[model samples]
Target: MSKLEILALSGSHRHGSFNTALLDNAKRLAPKGVEIKIYEGLDKLPFYSEELDGDSIHPEAKRLREAIASADGILLAVPEYNFSMTALLKNALDWSSRPAGRHVFVGKPTAIIGASSSILGSIRAQLHTREVLHALQADVVSRPEVLVTQAATKFEDGALKDETARLFLVQVLDNLVAKINTSELIKTASQEKAS
Candidate 1:
């Protein structure tokens, strides 16, 4: 089989976002046989409307779907906004989840991490995001949650400077890959049984 590829999305679109930096760190720390691709253009995706979702759907939505479809798993570095995930990320997910069970996020393994300047980190946002993913039927990895709270102290020069946080993020990525592997194995076994 080919290498497992993970598509990473940062919930924040702010300049020099800590969540985006977390994804950058994940890319650098990913284990061998795994690849992390960070998705850009979240800002380009228009608001999702089922009325426009059929043939005239926005091109950016299609890009998001294609990107998710090509990945073996997804890695989300979400930031909190009013104790919930950013609307930008939610919009992208809404676009990707269209057409019901046929969307790319279904059955795909996903892992979530977050950061914030507050001591609480982005835990609330992550929880909400997890629930949404679960509703979409994504196989979310539940262990080794990484929440980089007080981000001002943990990151510097647009990178994750804290060793502990870096290690935790790496653990999350590793677990994501493992979950994807398990999913693939199950799929193969089910196919064999059907044959």
Candidate 2:
């Protein structure tokens, strides 16, 4: 079997973001057959505008779209912002959703996990993100979510060193991988039946 191509998108833009650290830790603990890549250019995407979208879309926007288009699955690490998703992530999604008929996020498999300093651990943000992904026509993994609260205490020096958090992240990754593999198998079977 080939390695699963997984795109890890961090919703926080801060250099020392806890959510980013969690994603970084996930990269280290990813299963053997999963190839994880962290996307760090969400801040570069401009606000979505139909007039600016054409054959000549912004280079950054184009790059982000292409990354999503090429990925087999996506893992989003979101941080709560006033009980909602961040503008940076929302902006990236907006750009990717443009050209209506040619959306990059359509039919993609996605999973969301979040970490925050508050006790709620960005749970609301994760819920909102799941809804947004659904609207984008994504096959979102709905189980085994990771919501790390008091994130500063769980991770140290830009790494998630806590035993419990690490275990939860592993479970989340496993669930995501299972979902991806199952979807792939179903797709292949459908193609065979069609043939």
Candidate 3:
């Protein structure tokens, strides 16, 4: 089988963000057969505006869509802000889910992990992220979520320092790859039936 590629997107734009560090750790801990690419272009996307929702969209939005389309799965590293996902992440998702029903995330298998200084460790933000993905009709990997609490101590300089956090990230990657494979199988079976 060809290697699976998973796009990694972090909601946090802060330099040396904990969530970004979690994604970096996940890339390091992922099994050899999978490839994870962290996307850093969320800052370039404009606010979702209906006026700009024309047939010709922003170049950054197009880039995000193409990246999602090429990947076998998606990994979202979210930061909690006011008990929900950061606006940066939400805006990225909004841009990708545009034009109504023809978005790149439709039916895509996605995994979410987060980090925060709070004891809950961005769990609330993860919940809200899941809701948004579900609304987009994306297949989300619900288990093996990595929630790194006390981010100040768990990560340093955009890297995860905790061994347990690394382990959870590996688990999340494994589950995401499995979900991608299962989705491919279903798609193949459906194609066969249709033919």
Candidate 4:
């Protein structure tokens, strides 16, 4: 019943990144009572290292972990490079999935969307991201995938202009909220049963 806070991560840090634009549009189209915020520190994160991942973790990594831990769900605007997810994204994931028992991504509701110039529209990146999320035990929304292929033709001035893509993005957000709600319901039921 409370507002939902959804954190979005874009894989690209380019000046005019299509993935960033896609996330912007997603923020605009997010349903009422839900807030979608973009995480902007991926480029600042150093490559994951166990030595630095102890109590002395980088401030940015700590920020990223806190954001993921507090959000009701996660939205990813994945970008593909070399037929896989960008290092920025993978690095963020690696940084967040640390300390073994206290990872924030476990059981978190997640949804994936992407945009690319390639015809496949970052499909490989999203697939690879899903695999990584699975390994972290995150719950992912699996329906109505949003893959904006040939992205240059689908947006105008950094906003998603394609009606079909907009529809799919909205559906993805809705499904993410539904997943979060379902998780809350199950948790409440389990607590009641235990009581």
Candidate 3 lowest-lDDT run of ten:
50-59
Deviation in Å, model 1, residue 121 alpha carbon: 0.8
What overall lDDT goes with each candidate model?
0.91, 0.87, 0.89, 0.93
Better of 2 and 4 by TM-score: 4
Local accuracy of candidate 1 as per-residue lDDT tens digits, 33-126: 9999999999998788887688887888888999999999999998999999999999988998988988888999999999988898999999
Clashes of each: 0, 0, 0, 0
State the lDDT of candidate 4 residue by residue for 1-195, as single tens digits.
678999999999999999999999999999999999998879998898998788898999999999999999999999989999999999999998987756999899999999888999999989999999999999999988899999999989988999999999999999999999999899899999999
Cα TM-score of candidate 2: 0.94
Q: For residues 1-195, could you state the per-residue lDDT of candidate 2 as single tens digits?
A: 778999999999898999988888889999998998999788887887876778888899989889998998999999999999999888888887876756877777888999998989999999999888878888888877788998888877888877877888998888888888888899999999999
Q: TM-score for every candidate vs. truth?
A: 0.97, 0.94, 0.96, 0.97
* Model 2 ranges with Cα > 4 A deviation: none
lDDT of 4: 0.93
Question: Candidate 3: which stretches are off by over 4 Å?
Answer: none
**Predicted structure 4: clash tally:** 0
Which of 1 and 3 is the better model by lDDT? 1
Q: After superposition, how far is residue 132 of candidate 4 from its true place, in Å?
A: 0.6
Q: In candidate 4, which residue pairs get closer than 3 Å at backbone N, Cα or C atoms, i.e. clash?
A: none
* Candidate that beats the other on TM-score, 2 or 3, i.e. the better one: 3
In model 1, the worst 10-residue window by lDDT is 45-54
Model 3, range 1-195, lDDT digits (tens) per residue? 677898999998898888887888888888888888999879998898877666778888888989999999999999999999999999999988976798899999999999998999999999999999988999999888789998998876677888887888888888988899899999999999999
Worst 10 residues of 4 by lDDT: 93-102
